[model samples]
Target: MTEVELTMSQRLRCLVIGIPQATFPEGLLRPDEAASIPYAQLAEHLPLPDTLELVVAPLFCDDFDALEIIETLGSAGYRRVLRIVAPKLPNRQIVLRELRSHAVRQGITLEMVEEG
Candidate 1:
């Protein structure tokens, strides 16, 4: 008899911070076409990367303080913090914000990525 081998896939979750007010390739889609699609629909078209956990409490302002909420989420199930940088955001503010969170008491570090 021959032995059978099998492989298992791991499920990964990732948090998407800062829902962009606008999208790239502007003017490519007609206003009607753009307005027709929903976030869930968009997610299907553009799949998230592997090894992501969850994105919690998107802070619009760099000065917004939500450490408790963030820490709670991090402790619950989150393993990594992924920061999304977009042209619409203030570059200096983002950098400063990242620096502030770098000193998290719970030892959570936000990894900033230029692109999703």
Candidate 2:
């Protein structure tokens, strides 16, 4: 994925991303609308804690790589991260467990999005 610096003035600098065939709804801050990303290319643009927030569309649902992303973010000193996922995904539990484990390994806590 191609990444650029976003200068939004917020405590949390979030990056919103959508997977292939997954639609990113309105209200997302897209730094580059014309860039396409490969699953493995995200390493280059991993968000730093100094930025405050990052949003990304995962290539695979509930995969280890996704957990790695969270771990990476956590290692960067990010205290919080919001992972937006499809409500209808089949592997939600797997992802959740993996995230939990990753959190445990990293000595940080993970929070899930609240449902209305």
Candidate 3:
């Protein structure tokens, strides 16, 4: 008898963060494109991707959790590109300012994707 080895294939990882109530843009992600996980579970889900996409809600500006998310992802070696999808909001400017600053310090390339 011969022994055979098996391995699991890895899929491209993309992180979408924001309030569940917020609407996600159509065609942002394919039905079978990527695995969806809550922001809270990001850390536990290891082997971070070189590219990451973040969909943030304006409401997140009220807290520091959003910053933490970016920092965490950067520290984990997600340095290729950090795509942010944010819609117009009362605090959109403020939130984006902070996120951009953090991303620069972390050496992560930032790409702001305007909401359609």
Candidate 4:
């Protein structure tokens, strides 16, 4: 697919992490628009895209888990901004602080959006 094939119109490739296909919100994205990879299959999707949109539950993010996610993104070679979509977290400040540092070292700009 990376053979530089010609297309009449531009295509938008969006890869979603930390969300499962079945449980993913319905109206937000169509079946073909994005691929929602569950946590188990995260590292298995090889030839990883340089950019990805992570859809994770903030409640699941603690200091250690957040670090693991950040390291995986770096190892996968995502050198651009990462847009994270999730609901507000009770301990957002603490988690954000931890992630911010690791994200910076990976050359990743973290944009957190409160999902509706």
Candidate 5:
């Protein structure tokens, strides 16, 4: 999203999945609007997000973990896009296509982005 669009979307809640809490990239998120969760703790209950909810996760994780994250987010009442950030991933076209289809079926939008 463009900077102006993001600024317009108030309280853009985000869940940084599996990334260490310490590496949450300070200043990238407004304190009240974001949090990082360990993959192991994903089973815990999460509040239904208000407005847009952006989920940041690694694309290189085990396939099951990726699917599980989607399921968990859906179960937690997340109804917006899950924006996964990865620097690089193999078989990008195939992976993105498959995941996009699955994400759509679960009533979630999937957006994959590469970042270093």
Candidate 6:
């Protein structure tokens, strides 16, 4: 019998959004409607990666939450590039800088890919 080859699915890339839930209107929004809102907000946070396998969805609670995720991955010996998909937030730059610095400190050659 001939052997068959199996391949794993492509790893999903993260898509972090910066919009907070507080910005949502007071009226009720359907699930689809809420999803569309974040896509529109992406324009404000341009320069995102052209292709994304997976999206972080909605928005990060705060910078700390984002950083913690990255740090945890780093500590786990995940050396591949880590993508942080987030919208344009006030502390976006600061967060990126800190992440880069943390990667350096970890000595893991962890590159951060951003997709807003």
Residue pairs that clash (backbone atoms under 3 angstroms), model 1: 13-52, 13-53, 14-53, 15-54, 15-55
Each prediction's TM-score versus the true structure: 0.34, 0.48, 0.57, 0.60, 0.71, 0.38
Q: Let me know the TM-score candidate 5 reaches against the reference structure.
A: 0.71
**Candidate 1 residue lDDT tens string, 1-116:** 00110011123243333353435356553322222122233233233333444343333435333453354444544445534343334575765476447435445555444434
Pick by TM-score: which candidate is best?
A: 5
Q: Which lDDT values do the candidates have, in the order given?
A: 0.39, 0.49, 0.53, 0.54, 0.67, 0.41
- Relative to the true structure, candidate 4 reaches a TM of 0.60
lDDT of 2 by residue, 1-116 (tens): 22443222233355543354534446664433323344454455544335544455452354335566566656756665545443445776776776677766765555444222
Report per-prediction Cα RMSD to one decimal: 12.3, 5.7, 7.3, 6.2, 7.1, 13.4
Segments of candidate 3 deviating more than 4 angstroms: 1-9, 18-32, 50-64, 90-94, 113-116
Expressed as tens digits, the lDDT of each residue in 85-111 for candidate 6 is 555567867766876687666543433
What ranking emerges by TM-score with the best candidate at the front? Answer: 5, 4, 3, 2, 6, 1
By lDDT, the best candidate is: 5
Q: Worst 10-residue stretch by lDDT in candidate 4?
A: 1-10
In candidate 3 the C-alpha lDDT for residue 28 amounts to: 72
Q: Is candidate 1 or candidate 5 better by lDDT?
A: 5
Give the lowest summed-lDDT range of ten residues in model 3: 1-10
lDDT against true structure, model 5: 0.67
